[model samples]
Target chain A: MVLDFYFDFASGYSYFAARRIEWLAAAHGAKVRWHPVLLPALTQVTGVLPSPVVPVKWAYVTRDMQRTAQEEAIPFNPSPAFPQMLIAPGRAMLWVRANHGEEVAVSFARTCFQAYYADAVDIADKAVLLGIAEGLGIDGSAFLAGMEDPAIKSQFKEGNERALAQGVFGVPFVIAEGEPFWGYDRFGNLERWLAAARKVA
Target chain B: MVLDFYFDFASGYSYFAARRIEWLAAAHGAKVRWHPVLLPALTQVTGVLPSPVVPVKWAYVTRDMQRTAQEEAIPFNPSPAFPQMLIAPGRAMLWVRANHGEEVAVSFARTCFQAYYADAVDIADKAVLLGIAEGLGIDGSAFLAGMEDPAIKSQFKEGNERALAQGVFGVPFVIAEGEPFWGYDRFGNLERWLAAARKVA
Candidate 1:
């Protein structure tokens, strides 16, 4: 079964999951479909206040993300200016997925996540995004054009609607065999479920 | 180092953590302090919306709780009327801790958690709590009186205030070496922290 991995560019935990999911999926011989959705769009549907907006959880998450990153040995240094406008990167990811293949899209998503969370770059800026795309061998100008394409924007919006419809309320949400797992912490549970399903298969 | 476990009687994850924490602490030669807090009070301080109030998250939690409980081999069948008022059980737990020893209070807390989560009994009702106490060989009438004692009620309020001041926004929150780990999923992190602290010691 294919695993649907939903993430938003602004989420640190999503960045953590992005770094590990591919390997985990490979180990289980599972294919992963990365869907980048606009997190703010989900507020109307999920009624979830952004974690950064909630003071106590925000503090806990900041500490937890640092500790978790260190534990996983992943490079993580989130920009102080967090909860950056993810719309541009979100659309860019979908644009790459539509034009270039899934592998290229995955690479693009990872770069955006790393740029924002690990490198502390301003991902919301068009210049920074173009730089990221150009570094990946994708023509900067064309990538910018694609990001602004109405069709690509429509697809991004559709992706958010689809995520809401699929009961996704948070980033790093994983769905396997129609069962939903929310958060990177549930990755272990997802791994077990995948193994169990593989054995049954 | 001692591990401080902050829990709420109505929290399913707290029940999951409650069942395993003592043993986990003992394995590492760590002492555990069980602090039962009123979750609603922390909400006022943290401005975090209750999980159940967020529809999609609430649905995920229902499934996650069941799956986690099964994985942990803990009997869990949440009461149909969940988010039950935890005040009575909260007060009773403090009473047990005040009169009896810490071990007895831990036992009383476990029973209360099991009564609500595993047995699907209404922990909000004083009669049900008294029955649980009587079954545990505690003086049922005296337990009832303690639950209602003005001093005990004041202590319970103090406990909630203490939890708020400590920056507790969720259940199954663990603190060790001044680091806070929230949720049952963070137990692994807590273990690692304990191990590292021991090495330094």
Candidate 2:
């Protein structure tokens, strides 16, 4: 079975989930469809305010992400300027997926996650994104062009629309056997569900 | 060390956390102080919208609660009408603590959680709350009178104010060593923190 893993680049929780989902999916003999979604677009459609704008939640998220990162053994030194503009890297993920393949796209997405979340790089900047793409053996010029392509932009919009249609309101939302598990913390329950489904199969 | 567990009666996540925290804290040689806060009052002070009012979040919360309950092995059949009015029970908990003592009050709070979350009882109803109190060997007439007591109402207000002063913006918030862990999902992290603190001691 396939797990539809919906995520947004700007979300720290999504970064945490991205680091682990591949191995987690592999353990259950499941395939993951990494769907990059624009969180703001989904929130706009759902009419829910972003957590960063909510002062208390924003503070809690920063602390939670730091502690969770340590628990997961992943480096997480977020940039002081959080909720970084993710449009460029987000669109680039789709661009790579379209041109290279899903494997390369997943790798690209992880690099993006690390660049922003661990290395504190400004992923929103075109130079930094191109640098990340070049390191991944993706042609810098083609990658830059793909990111700006109107078709790629449209694809990103379609991804957001599809996420909203699928009742996904937050990052790291996973859908397995038509059950939606939202958030990185729900991964344990998702794993249990997957194990139960496998046994039934 | 004391693990201050801040929660609200109306929160499903809080119920999930409530079921596990005491034992978890005891395992680490820690004492638990259960502080029940009115969520609406905290949200108003923090200028954040309630999750139930946020359509996408409310949808996620219901699904998350069900999955979490299964993982925790707790009975969780949410009332058809959710975001139950928690004032009567909230005040009643403080009254029980003031007169009966902390241990009995914790039992009283757990019963309230099961009454609303498991049995789907209307905890807002005065009769229903009094019945729950009486079941716990609490004086039903006194509990009824306590619910209407101005002193209890003022104490409830004080609880909300204290929560706000402590920077509590959400339910199931656990504070230890001046660090806050928000959400029931973060209980794992909280447990880890407690263990580390104990080792140092």
Candidate 3:
């Protein structure tokens, strides 16, 4: 079985979901396909306002993420400089996926999430992107070149379009067999769903 | 303990939450206080866009409600003519709470949810409000008068303000001990929170 995990570097829920999805997939004998897209760009396309769209929701999300992270012991530290222009990490992550295979891509994505969320690093910086690539044993120059690849750049745009077409209004959106589930909160449903599908399979 | 259940007539998740909240509350030895606020008005105040604000969400919400309703065996039928102007019912419900107590208010709210989401009834209409009141053995004339009460009208506005003050961005929003949980999906968290609080109490 396969679960298509669509995420964005700018989404806190996506950070939580990305951290947890692999284990969840493994438990249900399912493999996750990581699809990174720019949340701001996609939401703009879908007429869904970007996060911090509302002051109340912004306040609520901060509290909610803290509460859930505490409950699950997920070591969440929201970036002091959040809502980072995450297009860099988003494009780089997908570029890694195309070149380095899913495992390495996932590893690179995890570092970006950790840097932005856990360590408050500015992942949008090209220097930071190169640093993360070097830390992951990928040649810094090659990774930087990959980040600038015209095909990878266009792939990011097409990826956003494809995700919007998939009815992905929110981050940490997961799809399996055309069934969409949104949010890290929906992980319970997704797990149960994967378990059920495994049974049928 | 008390659970503040903020709901709007137009929210399908509110219908699902309203149906199940009492049972869940009973299990945790808590009482639910029903607060009816206009979802559209409140979301606007918070800058949280209304349902159908985006084409993708409108489509997703339709399928989501149906899938969830089926999974839970809740009878579900969306209003053919939705986005009903619900000021009449909202006012009537608060008035019922003031005069008739929480139980009557809850019963009225449940009927409104059912009418709009289960039976495709135009619950926003004054005639429909009177009919629901009459069916519940309240004086139809008195109910209509209460819906028009100046005090009730002010209360409705104040209620929306209060809900927003407490950071309500959406319906089926439940708050306990200063912590807010949104959506029918958050019921699991609500139950766990309540149960944990019970132990500490």
What do the candidate models score in CA lDDT, each in turn? 0.86, 0.85, 0.83
For candidate 3, write residues A1-201 as lDDT tens digits. 788899988888899998999999899887898888878776664555665766678788788888788878888776677865577787898878877887888999999898888888878788988999888888888888888899988999998888887877678899988888888877887887787787888
In candidate 1, what are the lDDT values of residues A1-201, reduced to their tens digit? 789999988888899899989999998999999999877787666556688877788898889998998998989877667866578998988887777788888898888888888888888888988888888788877998999899998998899999999998788899987999999999999999989888998
Q: After best superposition, candidate 1 residue A104: deviation in angstroms?
A: 1.3
State the lDDT of candidate 2 residue by residue for A43-129, as single tens digits: 765565677887777777787788888877889887665686578888999999999999889989999888888888878888988
Error of 2 at B105 (Å): 1.7
Model 2 chain A lDDT-worst window of ten: A42-51
What residue pairs are clashing in model 1? Answer: none
Per-residue lDDT of model 1, residues B1-201, tens digit only: 688889988888899999889988998898899988888787765555678887788888889998997887889876787966578888898888888878888888888888788888888888888887787788987898898999999998887788777888778899886899999999999888888888988
Error of 2 at A156 (Å): 0.9
Of the two candidates 2 and 3, the one with more favorable TM-score, higher being better, is 2
Off by over 4 Å in 1: none
TM-score of chain A, model number 2: 0.96
Better of 1 and 2 by DockQ: 1
True contacts kept of 2: 0.39
**Model 3 CA lDDT for position B118:** 84
DockQ of each candidate's interface versus the true one?
0.61, 0.46, 0.54
| Candidate 1, residue B29: how far the Cα is off, in Å | 2.0
For each candidate in turn, the TM-score is: 0.95, 0.93, 0.92
Each candidate's root-mean-square deviation in Å?
1.7, 2.0, 2.2
